[model samples]
Target: MKQQLVFATNNPHKVAEIQQQLGDRYAFLSLQDIGCTAEIPETGRTLEENARLKARYVVDHHGRDCFSEDTGLEVYALEGAPGVDTAHYAGPQRNAKENNDKLLSALGDRKDRLACFRTVICLVQNGQEYFFEGKCDGRIATYPTGDGGFGYDPVFIPDEGNGRSFSQMSTEEKIAISHRSRAMVQLEAHLKKQSDVARPTA
Candidate 1:
């Protein structure tokens, strides 16, 4: 049987992405699969901190090897107002559409629309913790576009695109060179090199 890993996340899309990214190396599991109902507090000041907090929580409480990741949309025009709070930027109660709309409104007259998506992943096993970061630079569209993807994908135009948004791209295309995917590649490589995945010692 493959090693079963608990992914500290409630989002099905994220879990699915990770499952595919891992490429059959291990059996994927999520917080809901293990009966974790309490919300993981995102008290960290940065993406790495938040990711480690969630990953460590799974291992510490669930007593299993686990990993977690946090992603954010950083807009240069907004001075990165929502870097660490992408999901709840418009408040935790609203959905993805609300969050995206607010972001576009905030950048009303800005022509540059320069922005990027960043993902910080924390992998932990047996008290060992490692952090990996991935970033994709792009520009924000004046209005949302396409129907594919989730979250801010509708308005995120990748660096390669002249103006097309992420929602218009296929899943394979998005995964091929997305911020989270790049970070996962780095993380998977690191985990392979180091047998011991544990929290850093002081």
Candidate 2:
């Protein structure tokens, strides 16, 4: 049987992306799979804090090894105005289109479009916690483009990409160089190390 690790998120997109990135080594469970209905509090002041909060919640309540992550789009010109508030930038509605519109409006007539996507993952296992971080430096597009990704994907263009927004790329293409994928690479490395240590020597 594959080992089970709960992911402290109900978002299918996030769970799917992570599972795809990490592969079939371990079975991944989402908050819904564990019967967790209460909205996990994310009142943390930073990405690391929010990720820790969610991971801790699963560890304390579900009594399982799990991980959680918080991602934000930081615009250099805006001085990171929407760092922690990336999801609810426009309002409590959490509307993606509105959020993108607001971001564009906020940068009206500004030449600088430099930005970056950052992800912080907190893994809690056997009462121990670890953090992994990843960043994708890029710039915001003058207008939203493509329709492939979710959230700010339509507007955020990765520097590594070929002059295209995240939404312009397929899932495989986006995950290849995404901030989340970068963080997951570090996490997978740690998990492998733990697995090796626990292996029985022949």
Number of clashes recorded per candidate: 7, 0
Please give each candidate's TM-score. 0.91, 0.97
Question: What's the lDDT of the predicted structure labeled candidate 1?
Answer: 0.86
Q: Over the stretch 2-36, how does candidate 2's per-residue lDDT look in tens digits?
A: 87888898888888888888788889988999999
Tens digit per residue, CA lDDT, model 1, 81-177: 6899898989988489999989999999789799999999999966778788999999899999999889999989999755678899877778877
lDDT of 2: 0.93
Clashing pairs in 1: 127-198, 127-199, 128-197, 128-198, 128-199, 129-198, 129-199
Number of the top candidate by TM-score? Answer: 2
Lowest lDDT sum, 10 consecutive residues, model 2, at 17-26
The clash tally of candidate 1 reads 7
